[model samples]
Target: MPERSLILRPLPPFRLDLTVWALRRRPENRIDRWDGRTYCRTLVIAGHPVWIAVTEERAPGAPRLRVTMRAPVLPAQAEERVRQTLERLLGLRVDLRPFYRQLGGDPRLGPLIVRFKGLKPPRFPDLFETLVNAIACQQITLTQGIHLLNRLAQAFGRRVKDHPEAPPAFPKPEDLAGRDPEALRALGFSRQKAQAILNLAEEVVSGAVDLEAWEDLEDAEAIARLRALRGIGRWSAEYALLRGMGRLHIFPGDDVGARNHLQRWLGRRRPLDYAGVQRALAPWRPYAGLVYFHLLLKKLEEQGFLQKTTC
Candidate 1:
């Protein structure tokens, strides 16, 4: 296999680790690897596993990211897959200038936006991966959810290397489609969650459900379609909308953690409910989800989960 490198230029002041941490959610996540200077992950690209290492050197002008892709294909094919994957996973193409200008000089959100200046909202590679993630984390602590996902990945997904110790890529629908429900349950998934996951995978594999097609629909219609799946509620649907479809307008009003963060940030005497969150975020309009990411980074920094990314 030949290793090829591609350079990406993000807007400016970009931090890959910040976005990686938000997506990985826990230090136990094996698929998303970030050790100070570079971030690496194994993704199944065109049915073959590929390992990509991304690092941005401290340079003047715009930030530059070097993507080294290890794969069996020629340089052209490997670079294309790596570029597309990086575009989606690291949000390389998203322009945050509008978001920055919109909240400029605002008291509460202004400081937050400035604090996490280099942060870019990340997404799962595809809608199925996003849905499965949302399903696994529903009504549970993120740490526990990540642990379950780690076990599931190790059991079902293919390893980046032939070695037993290699990290596995996130599983595909076909990978989980044939999995036994009891196996998932044994991995700490509840009976209902296991059934939901199995059913969702089967539906996707059988062509009965088209989660990716939702991207072509309006936000309201797409969210409705997402919620139509079994075990997917408002929170899960909104989460899928933002993290899966990259719809930045949605803030997931029912998210207790986000609500708590928003309330505390605003110094509200009472907790925010669904309507309250909606009202509070109305001013941000289509950029409220960006605020969610900012708050998440703030929480992570305050709790000491943010590691210095300089080696």
Candidate 2:
């Protein structure tokens, strides 16, 4: 396959960290790895695997990004899509709006703006895997959930050529629908989780559920359809909607992290209920999804959820 290289001009300051986070969440997605001077993750695009690399290069006495993407499937238009995706992940559009005027500005939040611009939401496939894994991982630690997801992917996902490092493709609905529910249990799935997967698989295989169609629908419409599934409730539906469909406004109301962040950011001693969160976030309309991620990132920083780095 012919290799392609495209320059992402005037790259946003936080692009590197944002891309790294998306790549790291699922190691199987990586087809190759390089570190130092330039960092790159080789991944599959449009059924063909490709390598995406980024580095800071000095040009005209200023730092600029040098990005290289090699994939037969990297369409000419993909650069724009990738940029939009990165922006969505970093909460760039959501954090800057004047919507949160009610919450008095804190000088502390200033430093966060730069860093916040780099926080990319996890990838869509990873998000789906998380939802499935979370269902399998109720009351379990983060480590356990990851292990289960790894096992599921290993057992059911298809392998891609020339990408030994790439994760197995998630099982198609038809592939899983025919398998015995206990088969998944043997792979460490709980009975409930196994059943849910099968239910989802059946819908997919029977054409009763269309993942593609769901992706194109409005957020509210998508959530309603997801809720109709047996194991999917409001939380699961919102989780899937945001990650699966890229709906920027839906936040998982049941998440403890989300609740805690809202309380802290708003300077409220008590947690905000669903209505309160909605009301507080109303000004950020059309960009609520980005706001939701910013809150999570802020909480993570405050609680030392990850290592501190200059944004």
Candidate 3:
């Protein structure tokens, strides 16, 4: 199939960073690897996968952005959906105009302008691979969970290309429909994890679960539907809703990292329970997802996840 390319100009800085951060989480999403030049990631849209690459190069006039998107799907409608997905992921429509005006004159927040200058919300997958990996990881350490996901991908996912360094695309529902549960078990998936994965796959294959449509639903409805699945509960549902549908208000309160960060941010002596989390985040409203991302970034910064980037 011939590839189609689209260029996006003046991309938001925060959104670009967010996209890079997300792609770094898993190898399958690595769309390009050019040191100090460009970064890229792949995403599946309308069942057709595509690569998006962005680079900022010094130009004679002004700093220029070069964005190249290569996809098999070519219609304007499909392109529009991809564009909307990027916008939604980056929270571009929320209009921080008021916040900018309010803080423009404030001394304390003035410095934050430089730090947070062009930060934008990130784009992520409709179905969160992390959430699924987390459910399979329950009570296990981060290392164990990552290993399990790697194994799962190797066992069931397809090898679309043999890029020696990059992992393969995770198996789709049909890829695992006929596999024996024992196969996953042997791959170190707990019995419960195997069951949940199989159940999810069956739901996907049977058309009982529609991730795309679910992405457009309200948070409450989306969470309710996710929880209806046998293996998915509050944590999994919230995680999935946040990643899958961009529902910002729903927090996986069970995440120890989130709880700890909230504790410190609120100056609370004790850990926060679910209700406490809800109350604390009430002020953030519809943009709670952005808040969560910020908090996570803050925690990562504190923990030395990456060299502290200003703001």
Runs in model 2 deviating more than 4 A are 1-14, 19-111, 120-143, 160-164, 283-286, 299-311
Pairs that clash in candidate 2: 28-167, 89-121, 248-289
What overall lDDT, based on C-alpha atoms, would model 1 receive against the true structure? Answer: 0.83
Q: Compare candidates 2 and 3 on TM-score and give the better one.
A: 3
Sort the predicted structures by lDDT, highest score first: 1, 3, 2
lDDT per residue (tens digit) for residues 143-185 in model 3: 5776787677667654423233433455567777667889999
The alpha-carbon deviation from the true structure for residue 10 of candidate 3, after best TM-score superposition, in angstroms, is 6.0
lDDT for 125 in candidate 2 is 44
- Whole-model lDDT for model 3 versus the true structure? 0.59
Candidate closer to the true structure by TM-score (higher is better), 1 or 2: 1
lDDT of 3 at 75: 43
Which residue pairs in candidate 1 collide?
A: none
Supply candidate 3's per-residue lDDT for 130: 36
Best by lDDT: 1
Q: Cα lDDT of all candidates, in order? A: 0.83, 0.57, 0.59
Ranking of candidates on TM-score, top first? 1, 3, 2
